[model samples]
Target: MSGAKLVQGNEACVRGALAAGCNFYAGYPITPSSEIAEIMVRRLPDAGGVFIQMEDEIASLATVIGASLAGSKAMTATSGPGFSLMQEHIGFATMAEVPCVIVDVMRGGPSTGLPTSPSQGDIMQARWGTHGDHPAIVLAPSSVGEVFDLTVKAFNLAERFRTPVILIYDEIIGHTRESVVLPDRVDIVDRSRPNGNPSTYQPKAPAANGVPPMVAFGDGYRFHVTGLTHNEHGFPTTDPGDTEALITRIHDKVYDHQDEISAVEEFMLDDAEVAIFAYGIVGRSAREAVLRARRAGMKVGLIRPLTLWPFPYAQVADVAAGIDTLLVAEMNLGQLIGEVERAVAGTTEVIGHLRADGEPITPADLIAALPDPAGART
Candidate 1:
């Protein structure tokens, strides 16, 4: 477990979840994401955890949410169609302030469009999948090693924020095999449990950090949880003032700490005039394009967002300010480029190199879109 070994992204996700203290998993099998469920089945029992293949994705998320409420760290994995079915429960977890992890291995999709092919079409969906205005924490991994690390981070963030977290990986990364060294230990964070008298416990009460301490259902602490707007005591509230406060608290909890939650990987950006913004598997190609552009004396760089939900706007804007043009490469028909455009805000010219034909954007493809450095302003 110490030395490097070849691992697929799906398998790495299983290991990471187990290591992060995920004691329960409930998921239905689906292409490109089934491997995660398969591995969890073989491994969870040995780790003193529970693994159940639910009837469907909806039930899967519901079961995970119940287990989380009962004091177990839980997770689920799915592809595009399955992800669609779990939207309602995802909203439930958010409204109830449950802590759990959900993995989405992206494939070509409106409805099972291409089960085995890679796509980034879910970028917008992941951000706004569930109905209503809810905050989300999503992490995208570009490599097997990152898949392992980010899976652990996902669980930690979910517990820390008392909300659901999504770990997004494209089909290409999920199916691809690469060498990864398992670390002996990783920093772990557990949800804070209520320490006050059971009679005085208020599950929905506002904490200074905006994350309320959680208590288990059978712990003799009385509390109510509902998708409806709730008061500090956790009961359904009809008061306009109470409803507004509840919604604002949840949104502010994430957005107010945006700097702490956002993460981006910058490559050769310090002195570059042109840049490539990408994530997931396309980031691999963007890195190569940046190197090739540098070798040819065209100062180009790459910015890969490791945390996609918060969107890394500040870091992206900082990079955009120094560059004359920003190129966004993705496996979708320009899904993420919109975010890049908003972040840059016309300070620099933004263009996209996109494909939905189930093929990855290559280094040469991104290079071709790069503006001529000799004529571009630095």
Candidate 2:
């Protein structure tokens, strides 16, 4: 706890969540992500938090969401099939604007495809799986160090935005152990509470940040909240005009402030002809490739995403200026590369290096794909 320690990504997630004041965790132990729940079971209660292994992933997320409504910093962990089951409840939390975190240690899948394998296959799922037009923040960590930092950031972002935040991780990063330095609890941001009379308080009323004041069930406010479109008083509404307005606002809250939510780390990109776009486990390799290429006098660079949801598109475009090419590497066939292409515009030749065999790509794998623009294509 004092200095850096060797730890796995999933274990670091549990540690970071606990430090962020997560008091309740309910999750199913699925491959890749099970270490998160396992870590919580062993440590949560010691920190005055509660941890329960539920009947299934559906029940696991349901239980955590219930705890969140009761004013607890709650979370659940899962992989592919389990994430599929939690979709309905994820929608419930989104519609209700519940503040919570969901740790998704991704694996190869459509349905139980490869349990012990890795994949960025859930990139779109994490964004659109829950149904409806709700907006939520999602973070992807490339290293075990980020696994700690981003997990805490997810909780803070969820509470600040009053929405569910997904901490998406891949199996390669989740189960891999690395030395990580824990920060001194970087200012936890909790939702502002209503200070006036409990009788006059309205849970449905939006705060200055567009987040409504939330109190536990046993609180004297006892305000009503539902998944349906509601007014300031938390009642269901059938008015499409009003519903449309509210939905737009929800999307704006996060997207409009993406500068604050999105983050990325660029390496040697200031003078490179080719840029490799990567994230999660593949990013670790991408970093090495950048260093290797620079040492080899290849003049290549890297762009690693820290925030996947509110993607650092503008940053990418800025770095891509005058660049000759972009290479996106990932465990999935191609997911985030599309975003990189759109961000780079027509200034560069965009391409991709993909691995879909449920295994992580190596630094050499991505480096070998970097095209020498001055020398022409392969």
Best model per TM-score:
1
lDDT of 1 by residue, 1-378 (tens): 557799999999999998899999999999999999999999999999999999999999999999999999999999999999989998999999999999999999889899999988888888899999899999999999999999999999999999999999899899999977977578899998878899999999877989899999899998888998889999998999999888999999989988777889999999988889999999999999888888887889999999999888788899999988898888888777988888888899998888998878888888787878485422
Per-residue lDDT of 222-308 in model 2, one digit per residue for the tens?
677688887677788878877876787788878888887998888888888888888888888998988888877788888888898
Model 2's TM-score against the true structure: 0.95
Which residue pairs in candidate 1 collide?
Answer: none
lDDT of 1 at 27: 97
- Total backbone collisions for each predicted model: 0, 0
